[model samples]
Target: MKIYSLINEFSSLDPCVFTLGIFDGVHIGHQKIIKNLILRSRKKYCSVLLTFHPHPKEILNTNKKFFYLNTLSERIYNLKKTGIEHLIVHPFTTNFSKLRTKDFLKKILHPKSKIRKIITGYDSIIGKNRDSSYEELKKISHKYGIKVYKVNPYKFQKKIVSSTHIRESLLLGNIQWANRALGYFYTLSGNVIEGKGIGKMINFPTANLQIDSKKLIPKQGVYAVKINYLNNMYLGMLNIGINPTLEKENRKIKIEVHIFDFFENIYGKKIDILMIRIIREEKKFNSIQELKKQICMDKINIQKFFSCEKKIR
Candidate 1:
């Protein structure tokens, strides 16, 4: 997939079918749109996919904290896995936000990108003042001689699939449900960094990871997860919390994971944590001994969850 930051730089000799959106999680709803776009593009013999960066909400609303399931690079990585050929990630700015619905289509979508068919999720809306809708988009597309297609809703367990639903589930520590809707594990990748080695002192050496601070973290808790490092999969018990039990005078949040049956120097290496299930909420203990005891229980629970032996595989 080719990624371009400016619409003017998009140069697809083949006619293109495009889907425009922030696509925060690229969740099932977004998948439906992209699937249809790719199918349509294949039938029409064209390249496909146009997305935006910095999410429209980040550009339009300044007061709210911006949260993302995946970082920009991660999002692009996941999207490319869907086999898109031409991916345009135009930078969102105040000037882009001010463009009227019709002007945006004529100036950017139609002329610059040469989009032949525009596909979008059913709930997509655009334009200044949020005036554009699927119905209105059809009207405008007709005037400009561009075909517009709105994908039907994607649902899981009778409810529509959406990034908002996924976020809520993750925040509530519903990893199973969220991953079911996402059609993949809810994964977080980060660089493993050196820490106080508290887990090691407790007899369970952990690889501390510093995740992207801007990305939304799942609920603070211990979780049963799979750690991917250097082409090996290891059963891991992950903790995301303030380590209230281990800290005596210091105060800081931390994310640490103890891989079962594994001992390796992984600091400075990239690790991918794929959450499988929530083990327990983070809590404080009376002493290091108590914390160690609780960690033992966490290990036992994780072993049962994975139905694996006491060894990491």
Candidate 2:
């Protein structure tokens, strides 16, 4: 598969099957659209997946703001696994956001990229202020002689799957539900950094990490997590909150992971943590003894969670 960051740089002359969207999480909902695009492309044209960078809201400075499930790097990594033939990550700018539906179709989709067909979600919209809808896309397609297909809703159990639904679930500490929609564990990757040596004194050593500012942080809680580093995966427990019991002043939010049965010099190493389940909400203890006791119990609970090998249903 080939990736293009600039439209002017693309020299591919083939007419291709195309789809365009933010595709935030590349969740199950977005996956269905990509799957359809691939299935349709195999028979005739090269598949093209066009997405945006920096998010449109960042450029438009809209009042409606959102936290993303995956960063641009994460999205590109996930897309490469989908067996697509071509991927275009177009930079979103204020000037591009101002294009009307008609001009966008004529200038970008039709001539520049040679879109033979466009696939999108059922509720997808484009153009300024989201003025374009499924109907508008169909109307414009007729003038350009391009085919348009709207992917049907994807569902887990009985509820419809959406990026918004997944974000809400994560923010509320529902990792299992959000991971179900994601088709994988919700993950964060960062460099392990030095932290106050509180965990060490308590017999539980932790590796502190600094995550991206643009990334969406899960709800403040203790969770069962899996750590991936040095090409190995280890079961771990993570705490995502200010260390209330350890710090009474100038508290700072942090993510610390205690890897079980593992000891090595990992400071400055990049690690990826995948949240599997929430063990408990974060709380302050009256004494250090209570906090240490609760942590011991949490380790047992995480072991049980892994022992049962509860896979998403």
Candidate 3:
């Protein structure tokens, strides 16, 4: 897929079918809309996806903590897998947010432009103050001769699948529900960094990860996960929390993973952690021995879990 940092950089004159959104996780709901877009564009038109960088929430919700399900690069990577021909990641700023619904449509969907159709989720709204609904969009786009299509909400277990719901699930450590909504495992990618070597002392050395602050972290807990390093997958257990047993004075959250039966130096290397299931919530232990004992049990249970998962597959 070809990616452009700005809408103006996309100079293709070929008529295109496009959809625009933050598309943070590219979850099932977003996938359904994109699928419709690609189907509508097949052979006759190019399939285009337009997303915003830094997310609109980051710019507008200045007083609230806004965490993104995927970083800009991760979102691009996920979108590429859906067979989009072109992606426009427009820079979002205060000025851009001020564009009224009609003016925004005129700029991007003018009668002279090549964008022929737009596919969007059923509930999607845009423009200043999010005042434009699907009905409003259709009315405005009619003047520009652009067609509009709305994909019904995608649902799993009777609940609507959405990025917001997935984020809530992750924050609550509801991995199964989140994964079901996403249609894939929730992933966190970062570089390995030096740590206090406390895991090593317990015979379960870990690779400390330095993740982007803007990326949403799951609830503080120990979890069963799969690690991707150098394109190889390994079973592992990850802990996302402060080490209360070892560091009484420190309260900063830490993310560390111990790959079973693997002991290669990976400091400074990047790895992707795919969350599978939550094991247990992080807590303070009475002593180092107590913490080590609990971790041993965690490894055993996680191994069994993977074994059963393999059998089910």
Which prediction has the highest lDDT against the true structure?
A: 3
Off by over 4 Å in 3: none
Please give, for residues 220-272, the per-residue lDDT of candidate 1 as tens digits: 99999999998899898999888887577766677888999998888899999
Specify the highest-TM-score model's number. Answer: 3
Per-residue lDDT of 98 in model 1: 85
> Which 10 consecutive residues of model 1 have the lowest summed lDDT?
105-114
Instruction: State each candidate's clash count.
Output: 0, 0, 0
TM-score of 2: 0.93
Q: How displaced is residue 21 in candidate 2, in Å? A: 0.5
Off by over 4 Å in 2: 61-66, 111-113, 129-131, 310-313
Q: Report the backbone clash tally of model 2.
A: 0
Per-residue accuracy of model 2 over 104-176 as CA lDDT, tens digit each? 6655555455777888887766676465556667887766788888888998978899887898999999999
TM-score per candidate, chains pooled: 0.93, 0.93, 0.97
Position 235, candidate 2: lDDT: 97
Candidate 1 vs candidate 3: the lDDT winner is 3
Give me candidate 3's TM-score against the actual structure: 0.97
Which has the better TM-score: candidate 2, or candidate 3?
A: 3
Which candidate model has the greater lDDT, 1 or 2? 2
